[model samples]
Target: FLICLFGLLSHYSDISDMSVYYSISVFSILGMAIIIIYVCISISISIDERYPDEFMNQDQEMYFPIHITDD
Candidate 1:
C-alpha cells in the first residue's frame, strides 16, 4: 500500500498540480481499500466453500459443546 501510494505520488508530482495529485491519491487509496475488501471477502467465501463440512462442525461445536461427546 505504501509502495503504491509513494509511486503514484512521485509519478504525479512532476506533471500535475498539487490538487490533482492529492485527488489522485485520495481516489487511489479509496480504490485500493475497496479492492482489498473485495479480495478478502472473496477469499473468505472460497474458504467456506472449500471447507463447508469443517466449518459446519466448528459452528456446531461452538454452540453445542456437549453434543460432540454423544458420538
Candidate 2:
C-alpha cells in the first residue's frame, strides 16, 4: 500500500497529463501487482512458520489431504 502510494506521488506529474482512463489503468495495475507480491510473500512466511516439521523433512511426501462436505 505504501509502495503504491509512493509510486503515485513520485510519478504524479508523468501520469497527470495523461487521459483519466489511462492514468487509472496504470495505477490499478501497479496496485494489483504490489498486492499480489505482498500476498505471495506473506503466504510463504506463514507456511514456513506453521510447518517446521515439513520444512525439515526433505524426503517426506509433499501431499495435502483434502476433504469435501456440503453445507
TM-score winner: 2
* Each model's lDDT: 0.74, 0.67
Superposed Cα deviation of residue 49, candidate 2 (Å): 0.4
Could you say which candidate leads in lDDT?
1
Candidate 1 lands at a TM-score of: 0.53
Candidate 2 off by > 4 Å: 1-18, 61-71
What is the lDDT for 39 in model 1? Answer: 100
Per-residue lDDT of candidate 2, residues 15-68 (tens digit): 554464565678779989999999999999998897655656655535533323
Report the C-alpha lDDT of model 1 over 1-71, residue by residue, as the tens digit. Answer: 65675576667545667765676778878989999999999999998887656656887866776554455
Compute the lDDT for candidate 1. 0.74
lDDT of 1 at 65: 61
